[model samples]
Target: MESVAVVATDRAERYGKQLVGHMSRKISGEWTGQSGYLDFNGRGRVELSAGADALKLELTSDDSETERLEEIVGVHLARFGSKDGMSVAWNRKSSEAGTVQGPYSEEDMKAFAEARKARQKA
Candidate 1:
């Protein structure tokens, strides 16, 4: 399943960087200025985009792992920006439910990384 969330915040970039830095110590994460992604030891992953006024988040994982993955990310972000009142409200795609394949594989992670890079260059 894939879930997307957008949180409006003036400190989008700061919080985005903080998340990357904090999470990268344990998991695999990459930050490329405005956009970045985290690979959760091959179980699932979440991509983050820091815009001028908001932060965009997209998570992909198995149906059984959706709530767990969301909580992992949501809890960290919530604590990081608690003073800013940053809240995460995930918008999930119902059609994709029970359709996610293997949560994510090595090949999928590489593909996503390449796609993000190409988009950034454009």
Candidate 2:
């Protein structure tokens, strides 16, 4: 029960593929399935499955880290054509509670923060 995070400036499809490839190469586990969404403006949710675990990655306009993950998911769909950038979060699951955790790389957080600030200024 661990997690990995990645930051990319590409669309969800491209980003998802990159994530999947990286995880497949780096982690020794069986992949299950991926379920998520992409929008007209190339922002969306990118969730993937590995064995009995689930990884949820989201991109949306809400800037609050305290916001609910589900709300962020909705916002991604609601603000499809908007110019605002998105916030992303990833969580993993295992047999034990709190087994999976994230906020992995500082650079990823910084990139997201910078993008959010730039979007706000625009």
Model 2 agreement with the true structure over 8-76: per-residue lDDT tens digits = 233544434444444345333222344433221322233432222223443332232223433433233
TM-score to native of every candidate shown:
0.75, 0.25
Which 10-residue span in candidate 1 carries the lowest summed lDDT?
96-105
lDDT of 1 at 102: 22
Estimate candidate 1's alpha-carbon lDDT, on a 0 to 1 scale. 0.78
> Quick one: how many clashes does candidate 1 have?
0
RMSD of each candidate? 13.8, 14.1
Instruction: Residues 8-101, candidate 1: write the lDDT tens digits.
Output: 8888888888988999999999888888988998788999999989998899988888877877787677667765656677778775432121
Per-prediction tally of clashes? 0, 1
